[model samples]
Target: MSLTHLDARGAAHMVDVADKPESRREASASGYIRMRPATLALLAEEGLPKGDVLATARIAGIQAAKRTHELIPLCHALALSKVSVDFELDSVTSCVRVTANCRLNGRTGVEMEALTAVSVACLTLYDMCKAVDKDMQIGDIHLDSKRGGVSGDYNRADTYTEQPTPIVAASAEAGRVPLALEGERTPSVRVKCLAELRERFGVSELSVPFHELASANVAGLKLALKNQYERFIDIDDQRLLCAVNQSMANDDTPLTHDDEVAFFPPVTGG
Candidate 1:
């Protein structure tokens, strides 16, 4: 049938795959990050001070795979039996290559889950060191290959295709330059934040049952983080970023403080 995530007019709606059969499916996806040589070196030496980058990234990748529905609208949730993420240092371009694989017995394809896992894991790495390198870009989050279910088997024809434009600067008002490097905080940051929030939190509208503040007053990404983490304790931006990075890194408990606000990772299945 047509995608339900799209609207009656063929807009965007979550596709209902309830009618599909349960079969063993697998998908492989890949992405990359072009980073500074210094950053690569630091990562190689464990100098980022955020613990093992690759290890945390692997966990984040798995978590992302599991939370694909939470990130993308109309995406079906599947019980992924196996998830694997690999990282390779590309010395030529000073980039980090990330590859993710997802497997499950389900009706729908797990392609989105595999790609999402790689994308989120890469973003987590960028966040962990964004303080040091704001220009560090996350690139190439895409489904490289897939197999099983009605869709059957498919793979990307181009091995080195350009990455998807996951992060786009928001359109600026007339007479004002679009948000770019070095300028008064522009709408782009807010736009990117909202985009990410929608992906990380299942809520399309930032409305939650327990949110203390209404969605409108979020002012900026503080809401995006809040959406993903549920509760935002009173904390500085750096610390909050760190806590989020750490939680993603270790797949540990949410950041809770006696007198401070915390960012909680989305609850996982037991």
Candidate 2:
């Protein structure tokens, strides 16, 4: 079973949030759907018998948020405080962008709720439109960010063009060689940001110094980081150390980046 599905044993269940305190929590998730222009014309003309496409999608998203625990076995049954859905049309791509924002005050955050809402909305769109547009693709589902927990705030620093939303990354045991590089390393070797690192390595945390980054093998890290950096910032070894050491974890939504706006690819409804 996927580690995401349950505890390590996969028998006795939900993660214990008993030690955690209640706080205001919020999560935003987004999804994309793309279809042919002819199907877009039909949707624009209300040619589908499904009535209002966006409205139905919104309802579906709301319903899905409430059922996240049922779908994901180990997720806690959260009493959602708020659920909101937004839709935007893209004439250029003949698609819609579906976003779901979920909020709650509890021991655990509502990231799963937000993600479930967006996924269900996209599925609903696919369900309503698939008869006419089987080619529609649902892609780029990611946690934009999350807030109000012990883990603290996180933000994606990369621009949207960097590539698909990063999942997570982490250093391998073998990859964690001593920081012994002399002056040979670049001012800053690109490291996989903590978010992508986590999904990739299944590690909950990482520790880095504020000095120049020294890794045994940073080739893959450089590639992943390059995929996200827009321009480049020239920093000395001290500054590099500070960034790696103080850099926040990737618990927040991946879409909430600093430079360019991050959006899931376009979504559509039949």
Q: Residue 61, candidate 1: how far off, in angstroms?
A: 1.4
RMSD to truth, every model = 14.9, 12.7
Could you tell me the lDDT of residue 120 within candidate 2?
92
Give the Cα RMSD of candidate 2: 12.7
Best by lDDT: 1
TM-score per candidate: 0.55, 0.58
Which digits, one per residue and each the tens of the lDDT, describe model 1 over residues 150-211? Answer: 75677678534533222223333346332233332222221222222223433222222212
For residues 1-270, what per-residue lDDT tens digits would candidate 2 score against the true structure?
A: 022222232223467788888899998888788888887777777787677887898999999999998997668998899999887767797787888999998999898899899999999988898888889988888778788897786444443444422222233344344222333322222232222223433343222221322222232232233333311122111222112222222212122111121111111221
Clashes of 1: 13
Candidate 1, residue 264: Cα displacement in angstroms equals 38
